[model samples]
Target: MADKSSNASKKSFKNIDDTQSYVHHLVWLDKNIENYTNQQKLNQWHELDDNIKLFSHEEECINYIQKQNDKNTESYIIFIISDSCSEQVIPKIHNCLCILAIFILTTNSENCQILNYPKIRATCLDTSDLFNRIRHCIYRDEASIGFSLLNKQDSTDAEPISLETKSNEQYPIRNLQEDQARFLWFYKCHNFMIELEDDDRQAKEEMISYFRIKYNKDKRILKPIDEFEKESLQDNAKNAIWWYSHNTIMFRSMNEALVSGHISTIYSYRYIIKLLCRQLKTLHKEYKKSISNNRLHLYRGQRLKLSLILLISNHINDLISLNSFVSTTLEEDVAKKFCLGRSKNNDEAVIFEIDIDLNSEQNIPFADIRDVSRYPEEEEILISIGSVFRIISVNFDEEKELYRIHLTLSQHEQLIVNKYIEQTFATEIDSDDQSILFGKLLFDMGEFEFAIKYFENRIRCLSDHNNHYRPTYLNNTGVCYNQIGDKDRALKYYKKASDIYKETKNQRGLGACYHNIASYYYDKGDYDTALRWALKALNERQQYQLEKASTLDLLGCIHLAQRDAEAARNNLQEALRIRVKYLSQLNTNHPDIGISYFNLGKLDSKLSSLIDAQNNYSRAEQIFRHNYPKTHPLITEVTQCLEQIKRQL
Candidate 1:
């Protein structure tokens, strides 16, 4: 089995010789990774690190690990087996980790890519005894929280991230593929809103501890017991009891996080689904015998996992839907809008239901609803439902689980009726948000692995929306493909967008597509072709008075490439002028403006405007020095230009 697994992994890698795969990516392994103290770990990994030949991209690595659920997969094995380690044996892996840590930071929440890799800190050793209790409080399933060693260290040991310091603290979590260092970036921007007195520090810390305990509970897990080789009936009971408590905590934590308005750790959700996987395997393991109803508590774990999964899905709608439950009259009006009624006898046999309670204390009975149509095949529900739901009353009830689904039907405009309501309802669900979000979220997060699907769906949706929306859709599709490094497909979409915009005479859209295509050519070092397209884009932008500053800068770059010193000075100077006029006032603290100024200075020097060029270059150097890292190449470029200009003076 071990050999088969090793070979299976090897089969996933055959292109190690590709130059694109080794863009000088550094792999620093920690030497102090308990049980990983070999001399190779001490030095940069050389010849022996070829075992990890699975993926080239970060997204591929994520998907690869997710597919592996076998009980045999070992963490930190890559540290020993992969060729990434074979590249160099840095005298220290810790030295590498220290430098790498500084670059990992979050700009906003959700879908942003994180840079820090934490393979070891996500520990399998569930040392905190209270973790189970916290898990029960957060999730309705215990097995959702597992324990396993997360020993993916390089030659240098990386530091573990500290847990949150506030009990009521909210963490905006991105997708699970993001390591913990990247995950914490989401919480940086939001101004957390909570009302507490000045002396509430201890209380806030306690609140943070509650979440920390649950959050720290492990994701990937090892087997449940080491002494299982001699397990008896006594051990079964203990395991069942422990798992039940964990499930209970997992349920509560997830639900509270949803309603509390904090971004959630996607790890918790993945952990729950994986718990379902484990439950299936356990059921198969116990299939031959009939132990007790308590053993079925194992299935109970899976059930809890599934429910919380559903709960999270529902929360997006529930949270975004807003407070509308004012009066029954409002519900009637909203229902009237979505009623696509038939004429005369209405022999079409339309079936629907709306459950509205005239009873007092109208809470979120609207949310308890899982579905909205009596028809089993519900495809176009969210749009249809949302169009009408936006006008109605939706509020929480005394029993938090119960919700009212209000429906109404009309025979053309002549006849109408409401039916089947005892204050609770069920309808077959139709989902659309998942499809819409699939491409958008993944693309935004730099996880291009999944964006292709969603972009396709969104394009189809926009095409169906109206003729005017198609250009925007095409442009977005092009951007997604471009980010994923599929320049050919990106150009195809940009061309489509450009064609569509031409038909509509939408100059901005046309210019933007040209700009994208020009940038693509520029990056490929096709100077003449890139310059031609960039000029074309500029002409299009000026024809419509579009935001031409960025386009102008590109045009300037093209002239510089052509070595047209006179034309380059004119274009680059104009581009810098436009940026200075519009950018700061527009509230864009554009650090790239410094680069543009430096470019203009170079053009001036080539045109023999040395003194004027020196000032421009000096300003560019100062701006780049202030806004960007001291080591950034832009600073060096500006410095060299300024120095050369000074020497001429």
Candidate 2:
């Protein structure tokens, strides 16, 4: 007799629990879920994922799945259904994007009679079989990679912008399309992980400690965690790929973090990520030497959501970057099995046909890891994270009933990314420190929370009390806090930074601190205090034209608040003159120039100079629209102001 308790435990769920960070959920839907045997099984399932939700009613389960789908969270569902409820529940939730795979539990497998639903991955009569199938489904879903599409419409030319060229400087590298910016950001993150250095013992201990806390409830995974801790201490880098090949906590956590773009989680797994990349890079060099063919073909098949397929289809000839370390095979048939197994209505079967040129000088690291893999028969070729590939075509194979996306490994996008970073580093961000630059990059990308976390981590790592970069880091944290609307915390960090700058006698740093303090006060409508700080900033920033302009702009805003129109006009005009002269040499459409124009327009509007206000607002609108996204607040605000100006005229 089979144990009904163990069998029921194999069931999975769909809905995500807010408290848990699970990428895969197991949803068990059975009416008799509260029965003694099933209740025991539910306890066992809880070991797998404590967030698992057991629903006795099919409608309740359906509603929960629907709600989760509407949330569009980064998680997938493996649903377990009893034969009685399969017909009622599967139909309603099978089409949900969150549904990864479905398993039907039946007392009699032969008479299951479930419809041929694409999500119906298996029909199991026994506990052991059901358990194995559910595990397999979860692993397969984990193998399904996430990618970002870079449409040609969103792409810029690959030609490197010369800082020396006055014409090129007028269009700064920072003015990148959303897709291009994301691609470069990922590239930079990959590099940061690979190049980051830390005490191996301490990093390993921290990683293991995190794993223990995460998987403490799951008894099955505890042994593997211990084994990894011992094994990693011996030689982690050499066995990195081997460990990753197994369906262990390391692989699961790393993949989940990467796919979701969870920066802090990824940072925690930096030790393992660095190990894997280093091993792959070494194998890549060796594999290159041994290969006789200059060209190679690879394949990876998985079910992609309809939206993703449409994105890829629309962006043919543009670039695509895999978010996680991708696994591909030389055997197309093996690859096809993954996608062709079951396709939910919301997602389509996709087989990626990749062409690689071994002779290309510009290539991201990828290597055949057969010898190093736990499952060597899979003949897996692991591509490093953030590898760029140009989409050749997207075609449907009528007979196979699947879409085939053709891609060629390309270096053009990488070159463009390098140029953008180089230009930004040389001109805008005056920092040689990679950590500071990375934090600044995150800030520029409008990832305020991540930037704050990153800067905080850097601060924690600093041993020198009087480090010159300390004030800058503190100020950067303050800036991020201000952006996120944490006014109190933002002001606290600014004051901390101000104290450091005074002690270091760093004039440039002091100027930035003063300006930020003034801006904070100005935001609070304290014009008197704002003016005092602005004057101090202006004095300290006299040698730095760009910094001086910013201080003047703040002073102008303060004077306007004080109702001193003459003072406001003088300050605003001087600020505008400085901004136009400096910014025109490096992107006249810069957001700073837009700020100046907008402020001047506000002053003009106050004085009842409708014509001057209209002209200033129009210039500000043009610049804001050119620089920011259409949905950006600045664009909407300026558009509203322009409408008001038109009504007044």
Best by lDDT: 2
Q: What is the C-alpha RMSD of each candidate to the true structure, in Å?
A: 27.8, 12.6
Local distance difference test, per candidate?
0.37, 0.73
* Candidate 2 worst ten-residue window by lDDT: 168-177
Best by TM-score: 2
Model 2 ranges off by over 4 Å: 1-138, 152-183, 199-206, 231-234, 289-294, 305-311, 357-363, 399-401, 411-422, 427-430, 464-466, 486-489, 562-649
TM-score of model 2 (CA atoms): 0.67
How much lDDT does candidate 1 score?
0.37
Residue-by-residue lDDT tens digits, candidate 1, 40-137: 44232232233423233444443343343222222212211122221232122312211111111112322222222322111112213223322221
Q: How much is the lDDT of residue 322 in candidate 2?
A: 77
Model 2 has an lDDT value of: 0.73
In candidate 2, how many Å is residue 193 off?
A: 4.2
